[model samples]
Target: MMMIELLKPDYIFESSWEVCNKVGGIYTVLSTRAKTLQDAFPDKIFFIGPDVWSGKENPLFSEDENCLKDWCAYARESDGLKIRVGRWNIPGSPITILVDFTPFYAQKNDIYGQAWCDFQVDSLHAYGDYDEASMFAYAAGKVVESFYRHCLSKKDRVVYHANEWMTGLGALYLRKHVPEIATIFTTHATSIGRSIAGNNKPLYDYLFAYNGDQMAGELNMQSKHSIEKQTAHHVDCFTTVSEITNNECRELLDKSADVVLMNGFEDDFVPKGNTFVARRKKARQAMLNLANKLLGTKLTDETLIVGTSGRYEFKNKGINVYLESLNRLTRDKNLKRDVLAFINVPGWVGDPREDLIARLKSKEQFTTPLEVPFITHWLHNMNHDQVLDMLKYLNMSNAPESKVKVIFVPCYLDGNDGIWNMHYYDLILGYDLSVYPSYYEPWGYTPLESIAFHVPTVTTDLAGFGLWVNSLKGRFSELADGVKVIHRTDYNYSEVADVIKDTVSDFSALSAAEIKKIRKNAAAIAEKALWKHFIQYYYEAYDIALRNAEKRLAL
Candidate 1:
């Protein structure tokens, strides 16, 4: 096949479920990469997302009525579109349009019917968040269609890009309504692949055997898988985040990605020089103070602060494996340093530790351990929580005698989680090491973020980022070299845990100068994963989408 000539889009409109909503990894993907796009396109690039932050103040969105006032008013009066145009509060402050998708719920059946009619999208076996996501996606599509019709001309080469299965409805809608506009669909992780992994099935091993539609029916993921699979086949250019997920897209979605658009991050959020040093110092002090008050043991600056943070998925995020490894570390008598391992996964936290707070206020460090000192915040279901249960099972009381202290921070550290009063990045800066031994991660952002903060991390080969790291190093990466890409198989939970234990032990034994060099190497690896380096993949996707669209239109 002869290569099609590449083309650039005059206008780009990207849509995702997490555009202004800081829900998950997609938020990081779109927000961080926005500046790079903004630099090239200026105001020509726009983001469309669901308006979930109506009554509450969304700190991430800075609303600007002047952005598309005439068009906004026209869309409202003429098309019944309710949207807020603004700038996302990231590096570039790219133009964002938040659509109020509430009204679409009344016409859900009609919308789904139209989708089925136009694109043969299967909503027959729909369940769970399918309706909600579809509605929002439909609304986003309506927003894009309205904008394009009112503002853009046929001569303008426009691209409508939708991210993930949650936003596939919008892409399908745009393709149906606006045939002239090129469409790009990027699935960060295929729904069926995640479902299979989340359900404790061996996805990677049996990836070839499981039919996408059959697994969708089996796992009760029919709706999401249907739309995702169809969108991949229909889009002008289909892409995934990494080579790992590109394989998943091929096997599970039954469509090979035109381009593998690897996720890239920006370092604009990170502090620098004196500010970085000061923040690190502050974070360490805060952590030590809390640990001292909770454990009744005076922790020093030399204490190794280790952490694992993400969504509280016990199996998938490798929180269970992390705990098991920490337990193994706790049993080791050769452990020289006191390890403060933080489980920063968000949960249903009740309140801050009252006793710890009182001690901090009174400047009275307790010589006796507080009740449930292993956790920073009080959880709603104290006895039922998995982390707490695991802690009890392992007898990790965070006592004075224990060399390893595990602290569960069961809340989001959004600068006001009551106990820490520090943002995640601010507090994570103090960590000596981070670990994300994920079993089913598409692209592990936690490990990437840790390395970006110059903290060496241990991730699994199951992670997309881990695979990318392996590609760079030409072998399984080690913590000594900044990233430990442990080969994690479905049945090797214990093996993975043991590897992590050994890695942490080795890292603990490293001299200060050695650790410094490792941290620098970690940051160096992070530099290569930056948007500046990885944005070219997205350009390739755009080029393919445009060329394909041109070919389709000519036909």
Candidate 2:
């Protein structure tokens, strides 16, 4: 078949569950990339998402009745869609539609029936988030349909992009109803692939052996996987964030992406020069003060603060591997500096420790460890918490004599967690290193954000970002190269842990000049991953979708 001519989009309608909501890595991907797209297309790009806040204020959304007043009115009076027109309070402040899908829940069965008929989507085994997300997506589709019919013409070159399995229903809805509009579907991570890895199964080693439909049945993921699989097949263009996920899509979804839209980020949030130095100094002081009071250990300002943070996925996010590596580092005799490793993953946090709070406020110093000095916040299920359990299993007591100490922060650093009253970005600047030895990461924003903050990190070959770094460097990447990409597999847990231990220990021994150079190198790598560079892949997707849409319309 002859390749279709590439086309530029006059307007773009992108939808994701995380558009204005700060959910997972998708928020970072969308928010950071928004500026680039906005600059390129001016006021032609719009984002659509679910408004789950239910009347309470969301800091991320700045509502403006004037932004899309006409469409908002038409959507309500004509199409009966409940939506709030606003600008997402990010860098570009892109125009957005926050749909209230509450009313759509009443017609859930009808919507599901239509989906089954139109796209052969199987919602028979639907449960949990399947209904809720589908309703939101279905409402979004109506919102877009109303807008396209109200404002756009058939001659307009437009692209309707939906993200993740959560928005698959919307993409399929558009394909069936508005075939004139080009459509793109991006699966950030395959539902079945995530289920396979989350269940502690070997995904990569046995990827070919595992049948997606069979595994979906066995794992009770028929609904989510079905929508994802069908949407990937039905959309004009199917894309993923990275090569790792593209491979997963081919094997699990049985369709390779037309293009791999590698998640890129900007550094407008990062401070520079003397301001950065001062902020880092202040951040380090705050962390040290908290540690000194909570653990009753006289940790100096010179302590190497290394941390890892994300959703509390013990194995998937490699929290287990990270903790095991920290345990090994504590025993390494070659370590020349005090390393303060922080497990920053949030859990079922109950509240901040009252005694720790008192100590943070007081100038009075103490030499005795507080009760459960290892964790900053109290978990709802203290005895059953996985991080605490892992600490106990590893015999990590955070003893004052040990050169390496671990602190588990089981709360989101959203400026008011009682302790560490700063945003994650503000506080994380003080860290010397970040590690994400993920067992299964489609495209890790943790390490990307880490390096963007100029903190060199150790990640695994399994992560999409790690593989990208390897491609940039060619040789085996090391901490000196701004990233250390450790080779990891289902069975190489011990080797990955040992490599992390040795790398961190060696890092602690690096001279000040060498460390500064490594930090510079890391930031340079981040520059290469900016949206200015990665936005081309998105254009490629738009081209494919537009060309395919034309062919379908002709057919």
Structural similarity to truth (TM-score) of each candidate: 0.97, 0.98
Best by TM-score: 2
Winner by lDDT: 2
What's the CA RMSD for each of the models?
A: 1.6, 1.5
- Root mean square deviation (Cα) for candidate 1: 1.6
Q: Residue 526 deviation, candidate 1, in Å?
A: 0.5
> What shift in Å separates residue 495 of candidate 1 from its native position after superposition?
1.2
Candidates' C-alpha lDDT = 0.90, 0.92
* Model 1 local distance difference test score: 0.90
lDDT for each residue of candidate 2 in 1-555, tens digit (9 for 90 to 100): 998566999999999999899878899999999999999998899999899886899899989989878877888998888889889999988999899998999999999998999888999999999999999899988888899899989999889999999998998888888888999999999999999999999999999888999999999999999999999999999999889999999999999999999999999989999999999988899888888998888899779999999999999999998889888988899999999988888899998999899988888889999999898888899999999999999999999889888999998888988898888998888999999999999999999999999999999999999999999998778889999999999899999999999999999899999999999999999999999999989989999999999999998
Superposed model 1: Cα runs more than 4 Å off: 1-5
Q: Lowest summed-lDDT stretch of 10 residues in model 1?
A: 357-366
Residue pairs of candidate 2 with colliding backbone atoms? none
